[model samples]
Target: MSEFRITGKAKLAGVIGHPVTHSLSPVLHNYWLARKEIDGAYVPLSVAPDVFVTAVKGLQASGFRGANVTIPHKEAAFAIADEVDPMARIAGSVNTLVFREDGTIHGSSTDGFGYIANLEADGIDVTALANRGPALLLGAGGAARSIATSLLEKGFQVIFSNRTAERADGLANELDAAWRRHFPKGDAPRLSTVAWDKWEEQLSELALVVNTTSLGMQGGPAPDWTPDLSRASSHLVVSDIVYVPQETLFLKAAKERGLTTSGGLGMLLHQARPGFKAWFGADTEVDEATAAYIRAALNKR
Candidate 1:
């Protein structure tokens, strides 16, 4: 740790995940650091699953303040954390880590808060519709788990749907939330799964549709599977966790049908927002100017 620290040099911060080359976090965060005039450098680290533990321990001991965790390793990150926030513990994932002076680690999962920030930015009223309508999620991966737990807390009825019914069912069971194999066909707004083939049929009662898969990421345009989002019966909002392309085909299809849409950028910023303040102090602000700059640069890719 002594060698890592230098007189009059920037502090170290970064993110860890497999194939982390796609991350724009360093860009987004560095802008904030500059604005705050903080003497720190943020970078992205590509740490594979097999090497994650060693890499994290090495980083902390080497004076790295903390880091953001991404896909394929959230659960494992949780296992290594000394303590976790309530949401992360319940979700069984960790997206942020803070290193204490005593070498103890504090972790938190920001996915839920990130999603909330995104939805709130779009003016979605989750509080007003508390338990009023059924929330439909499109995947059962790490991202889904965090968002689902958030939905449960907001008093919304949630339906877990995935290409694999068993996976969705498993998630629901873990959360103690009900799971359905098919989407609701009748007027009832119950939580149920919609077969991948029959997605169009279940689009009516879905108030919020969340995409947690990597469908609309860099090398893809989402799955060939498109659900009929043209239902006039309910206001369908399409939200995709993919931020790389900024706008995924899933959200684009929703807009073409005149439905509301959202992307992962909001979540990205909000998730990092808390940790930035925690590690850099409360005065640190990841302002809109910084976020806008990062978003524009990403669009060029």
Candidate 2:
């Protein structure tokens, strides 16, 4: 790391969340800011839900570049954006925002991009995986939606299995409609749903399985819960989006079985690249050093 310094021409950005004291955005973004040696700052803003809009307007007025929205503010960010990318509109949330010189705000959801980018970064051939078989997503929440949309775009058959079967069905239908609307003449996306408990039985036919639920987070749904990967094919790729413990139990089981696996940390790192570029005018790459920096930060907490 180099000595941190900023001047009157420094670019400014931050993250907005209701209770954002724990966000790693500052750690991740500031690392890139310093490594690139750009006169920019990325901070964390703990704003109440009611004042999110006002705070955003204030940032814009102060010539701030942009801010990332997390948790409860993702939807609000989408609502306030002057324009949004298709991913954000389809995902129903926004995580990255850019304030243009013309005073317009643009919002985008990088979850999908990060999800696929991380897999590719791990040397998993996504296009070949899509050709192998369908992908089974364990939860149908926001992360699942974003991942599903991205997979569907890449010609993968996406299957959803959530604790609530109805929610999975609804997500499938919503995404199906959106996919068709986006590509009316293109092939309709292969989307389906399976019962939560039966997902394991069908793993043999899946090329990839992702746990988008918090089942394996350090303080999430279940401390010791992990999916049964016994029935998964030898080629099945396992992934989890919960990065706190880095190697979630879900990923552990897959690793123990000798199957390829990807953790959530890479997604977290890659997801910040787009925002970093938009805010700092630099393209950042995630390599071993970058991963180690974030891993050290997580270990500290």
Candidate 3:
């Protein structure tokens, strides 16, 4: 077993997920605590899907302030929360969970916030750009759903551009946005499908592109996106949520074009800030130094 290192602080906050060890939340939260000189501590707790209920209940029962959920447990976190933020309710998943003093759980998904942060960190003006052009979102999973949910409500023109037409259409319907079977040719930023063979063909006109698919993660094949995207992206903002690798091919292409590019790391850091504030207080920002180190460490890995 690894050594248990504890910083002396009475208050407890943690992140809950099956593979919680890989999370950077602890470093972010503890860094905030250290900076603020607050007498609290945060840690990571590994909890399997089947044990979610018990694990969450146990945290609430203890002095634990709250926890963040990741991956397979986001939906479970939402289902078990006593109350959920409006955005989280719409997203149908919760990544940032708060265990309140009243034994009530307040669930929220920060995936969108994180995605937005990734854009901002990479020098993209998220608020300005999202409002200006149509965003091509690439997946329909919980993470994509949350990001689309937020972007739509924010009045951004987000279109579903996934390979799987049915799921993408369903997500668009749920969000009350537009959807289609395939990317319509000849202009008009439309929400539709991208045929497996036609991704690169549409790269020239995209204003912003997002990759919600887990394709670039775990040493897998790169995303089947368009070529010269970086050059094409000179007029676009390109981002991907695959943070395991600091630079994915998707962003690499965008960077090559000198376009605005962002990685998944910023989103990880930004999304946790709101949750940490909810767990502790609004006065806290994620520890920037810690977060920077975490990013560096991840890049090195």
Candidate 4:
């Protein structure tokens, strides 16, 4: 491996969070920068909740190109942004931020873009999934919002299931309204919620099942029950957003049943591309080499 050179003129980008030291953004983005020979640098910034606004403003004022928002800062990023892209607006959160020379910030959410990109990268035909049937999305949190919205925009009916019934219902209604407000004349994707207890019963009707919750994550509680794959559609594709352990128990169960499975790291990799383009002026590729580099870095963690 060669060293990455930087000068005072190098452009700056980074990831922001309360505890950002563990972020892999620096590794992923720097790999692209080094490979493409771009004179840019990506770092990690740990900003607390109370001073998030001040820190973001300071970054913009200090000539930093942009930063990726994480955890508690996504909502704040959306609120402070001078401009919000359609994806950010619809998802009601922003993970990527671009700083303008005039001290303004642009906000966008690439979570969904990355989610679908991950599936496509794995050779899963998203269009075919949309055509086959509705996708079952587990969780009603910020990540799920972006993913559900993205699937909806792609004309895929989404069935959202969360442990809390009200939260799931609330997200479904919010997304439906957002969809109607944004694409009034277009045929809205069917959005509905299922009780947590009932999600398994609908598996047979779903072509894709995605777990966006933290359940089964390392250190988190394991999923109480695995979906009965015997009753699921033969074309079912199971995905989980928990990537640290790489393959979550949900994915392991899916694999045992011989269903297609996708891990969350791809989303993390793919989502960085848009922000890299915004800051570095070039669209980066999420190739195998880049994936391998990140994987190696993750293992070291």
Best by lDDT: 2
Per-residue C-alpha lDDT of model 4 across residues 115-228, encoded as one tens digit per residue: 999999999999988999999999999889999988987779999999988999999998888878887897875999898888898888889999998887776777443556
**Model 3 spans > 4 angstroms off:** 1-9, 177-192, 223-233, 282-288, 299-301
| Order of models, best lDDT first | 2, 4, 1, 3
Q: Residue 152 of candidate 2: its Cα lDDT?
A: 86
Residue-level lDDT for 198 in candidate 3: 64
Selected candidate, larger TM-score, 2 vs 4: 2
- Colliding residue pairs in candidate 2: none
Displacement of residue 179 (Cα, Å) in model 3 is 14
Error of 3 at 107 (Å): 0.9
Model 2 spans with C-alpha error above 4 angstroms: 1-4
* Pairs that clash in candidate 3: 114-267, 200-226, 230-253, 230-254, 230-257
Q: Comparing candidate 1 with candidate 3, which one achieves the higher lDDT?
A: 1
- How many clashes in each candidate? 3, 0, 5, 0
The Cα local distance difference test for each model comes to: 0.76, 0.91, 0.72, 0.88
- Superposed on all Cα atoms, the candidates' RMSDs to the truth, in angstroms, are 5.8, 1.4, 5.9, 1.9
> Model 3 Cα displacement at 243 (Å)?
2.2
Which candidate model has the greater lDDT, 1 or 4? 4
Candidate 3: C-alpha RMSD after superposition:
5.9
